[model samples]
Target: MLLLGLAACGGPPAAIIGVDGVSTRAVDVPGTHLLPIYVATSRAASDNPHLLFSGERSDDVSYARLVVSVPPDRPVGEVTRASTLPPDPRRHFVVVAAQVFGSEADFVSSLNRDLMERPAPRRHVLLFVHGFNTDFPSAVTRTAQFAYDSGYPGIPLLFSWPSRGRTIDYVYDMNSALQSRDSLLATADALKESKAVAVDILAHSMGNLLVVESMRQMALLGRFATADRIGSIMLAAPDIDIDLFRKQLAPLPVGDPPIFVMTSANDRALALSRSIAGGVSRAGNTDPEKLAELGVNAVDVTRVTQGDRLQHSTFAQAPEVVQLIGRYLGNDGNLAEDNDDNPIEGVRNVLFEVTLLPARIVGGGRVVVVNE
Candidate 1:
């Protein structure tokens, strides 16, 4: 299958890294550094060098290392794969370097090498699961953007399943995601079992369904690591059915690490998903009270975004939202105990109330209004 640009113009950058499965070039971005991404995917391999994988499931995982160049001024935006070093200024990314691993053991060894190369206290690994309608390249580039923007001090890894990368192929994508449960679980297990300091998960849209189900299955089989290695499970704009989410949450062991649900009532994509599911309220769009009853942290971003499709990615696109996530992740699963005088503090059930400021006062500072 020919994978179109995973995201349109204003979306994440599209790029390729290797030729015939081998990385050939490295680019230099002045005034900024390259961000490396370690990726694991279940998509079937493809011969196309520009597009590494096809929209078909694979029994074994494919591993690759991607280096993305961050622009000096803006580190995140729509970027395209450049054939030469020092990409055009308009591009948000330049392919610095990449290498594909031949085996799972080789991949793990490379991961260990990358981990050791990071600075002190960089043991944290953020695992990102992309939503529906994404291709391999798009998934890689998007994860790089999130990792760079969040100021995360650890390795950023992606668990990409075979998404057809077309809105019309939602059903096909859903089946593909569901069929990759074992693959997702295997990736998570490898992370937790590795030498990484901590493992944190961030899932978007239907990816949450895969994450929730995988964790549920892992918990049922008594395969969780002790000592808090697996940290927060942040669900952004989850497209999970509320009833089904509750069912999935039920089997999880008590005292499972904090799970944060980041959602906005105005998510258009989820709205369509809700209608597709016969108007059932999605877990990501549900009220805080209901989420609190399920023993989860509800981070409502309704007011954080003013009126735009950017609301869907407010978790990553919004600077204030990125700070919130970076701070939360940096805190190592410690929910702010000092709620007093905190702009994010809210009522009992509400963990965070994110909002935005008028465009006048702080040109870029969008205020997060707490619902105290």
Candidate 2:
């Protein structure tokens, strides 16, 4: 009933800004930035070009490439989509080009070609995994917004699972996420084979469950052979049970690739999730100390009042928070040292101060000191 009421209040629009919105001509428009996003999905292909992929789970994984146009006027931490069918390139975030890869090999080859264009240090990949109630287009556009906002120069890869994209279908989304674990593992294997120097992962909400489970599977199978190649992992607003999260982390080797979990005590979405889980505390909203005991960096962002009313996406939607994330990404996931050249150094200087404590806390939108 609570989910139904929230759904009625209207969340992100469900409009399908299909492949029809793809325009090569849009790339030439003034002040438009083009961001290429490579996609690997476990969702079934749709006959509709507007929705290249549907929410139904697929037996096989599919690969595609999408180039999204970020309008010059768009805010740094926000993604503005087209309200109507024919999206305006100059004013709206639209797909400038789209391509479906013939095979996984072809996708990796294209990715390598892109990586070759960058210098060695910048030749990395940021893989994003979306949470509940996300569709294909939403995932692509969000990835573009994140990449552009963070000023990430590396490859942006999206691993999309079949999400029903309906608030009332939370159970369906969870099951679908679990079902896509094998596919996610395969995607990780593909990244390991790519030319990328490192692969940094950012998983949100229920997506964290899939990521942790995949890592657990890899651990069970002794697949951490390329653990060094895996970079920092940021789990933002994870929806997994706190106890279960601890259990999942127990199998994997600690600190192979640093793990950071962003949490907010005031996250209403996670509150609802807790209720849905029968009052079990969720990792994203649990006490930072509890999370730190598991050997992962727990970042408390309850003081950040900048996101939507739900406060579920403060990690990405807050300008200050996003800038901090950008710095962490650029610094190879270590926020212990200060970087003078970073554009957001002022914020970083004022926000984060390394301490010997067990957890980091961001308070009043100003202090974000992390405990190393």
Candidate 3:
């Protein structure tokens, strides 16, 4: 594919504006903006940030310290979607800078140096795992967009696996996701070792499968503390089979962090995923009753969307959804303690408020009202 990236730019300049405590690095429309990234990939690295991979997976994990420059033409607090990198002449927010590291220790060292420069509490990191068909540049931009929009006060990290980045390679991506499991676990360990106060893991689409399976592997291996160090596990538009999801949840140690599953019946992507798995319903599209029975917090986002076709990624685009994370789930795990009658802002309807249901229900109610 012909990538739509800006001409490569040199090092970052000094001036930056603070937008609501978010250090906004602005640029002229035709200019580039630099953002640092701690990349953990099972894919081979490229010399060019625009072409992030050679499109093949390796059995062993690879690490890199990258500084990606994306065009800030769309302004802060907004994301411009492109079917491909370097969207178009009018939509060119592409990577303009990249730096590679030779070893995991080197990458971790640089990441810690960057983290120490940030303000307090910002030492925490928000780790995002991208779903099927996402290339490295797209993953970086999405991570930046989420951080910018949420006003997240922490370092942002991305776990990019070798997805073929094409809609036709579903089976290939699934295998690639499985192949990337150990690398993801290594990333969790690296963050915890780096002195991050808390690490929040958010996975979207097929990436959720990788996240759950990797955490399960940790539990089965008796790495309970490592899994527990992950403060929150938020799955958005997960594409895992319902039965498999049950199996994955079965091994998690007791008192592990709460899992938040954001679902929407309007999620056409998950609907297609449901059909692809021989007509079995996917966990992301399952009924609230079943999710409650499983003992996880379920947020129904059918009423929220960014007017996008799939509606699968509304959690990152919808303002209310962003508010739910930034205002409620940030820093502390307070959202887990919220009740239906006293639900957090931007989280209306509590959709399914089972304490753990089938696992344990807080108040013994079949249905609860968080919002009228």
Candidate 4:
């Protein structure tokens, strides 16, 4: 009868939503906005191939859900497309409760409900963007896990860009990532404009470039009312050229929403990214010399290594990243504070600021203690 969930927005109208007679709705809350999701399938376009996860049901397909128009109960316009129902509706259109996310439109709306209705006003909304060579499923689950690891599983939003699921699809995926830039910007603008939502973006690898480029466009177009709402940007294994990042910073002129860059010298993928992308230095190669010059908060992640590269993608691949992310979520470290401050220079570990313990200056071997 009535499926009440989080939200409704863009794409196509008449979404099948995996179920036979499904509709979308938009829900709002204090810390996040719940966007509507519909589970449907689109005809595979030439450039766009279908994405598959081995563990998922065979019929599930990638679809976008939205609430583009509203007219009370008059069958208003929807944000996404309407495709034929899949064989398995539950698997095709399972509702997720995450940020500006849309596997199901009500996912965000539902998260809002859980936060304000069930719990309290949600404090943080961390948007996780996955990088190169990842399928849609890998991106979603890992992001959810990342939030779980950080102990903020109830916060709203997960942004997984459309990265082709493959290793050799590097250039193609890079270009594909480039294509999605505009949409990400649109989403960012929408979130910023939403009076009820406070947004933070965590973009990894190619997704970092995507979010940056989107922000740059917003900055150039003077979409700062939109830009300013961006709470913080945490880039892990950023896949952009160092020069490109500076240029991007120049245009956007970071002020409110600070930028935090996490790198790892041990990251072979970034080394390869540097080589293949033609001298485009990545955050993975960030050093004390270049970070401040580039106007980024460089957090070295070399010492925080854990999982297999997650398709050569860093950031959420390690458990420590989750802790670091948790610290950032608390909104303690400002990018201005981290500028030129290489916390890792002396020890060479994954460096980020935490409020729990005071700075430990290495005075001597075992004599090191917190600054008194």
| Residue 49 lDDT in candidate 4 | 20
Clashes of 3: 4
lDDT (Cα, 0-100) at 39 in candidate 1 = 84
Please provide, for model 1 over 169-215, each residue's C-alpha lDDT reduced to its tens digit, 9 standing for 90 to 100. Answer: 88999998988899987787667556798888889888888888888
TM-score of each: 0.82, 0.89, 0.78, 0.61
> Which candidate leads the pack in TM-score?
2
Between 2 and 3, whose TM-score is larger?
2
CA-only RMSD, every prediction: 7.8, 4.5, 8.2, 13.8
Model 3, span 31-113: residue lDDT tens: 54456667788887555444656458877667765554444445433455444322332443434445567777877888888
For model 1, the run of ten residues with the poorest summed lDDT? 358-367
> Candidate order by TM-score, highest to lowest?
2, 1, 3, 4
Q: CA lDDT of each candidate?
A: 0.69, 0.79, 0.64, 0.47
lDDT of 4 by residue, 255-367 (tens): 35556677667677777778766777775576634665555555655554464442234455444445556545534344223223223111113333332232222211011
The lDDT, on a scale of 0 to 1, for candidate 3 is: 0.64
Q: What is the lDDT of residue 12 in candidate 3?
A: 24
List where candidate 4 sits over 4 angstroms from the true fold: 1-115, 118-123, 193-196, 225-228, 309-314, 332-372
Candidate 2 residue pairs in clash (backbone atoms < 3 Å): 18-50, 351-368
Alpha carbon deviation, residue 364, candidate 3 (Å): 9.9
User: Model 4: how far is 285 from its true place, Å?
Assistant: 1.3
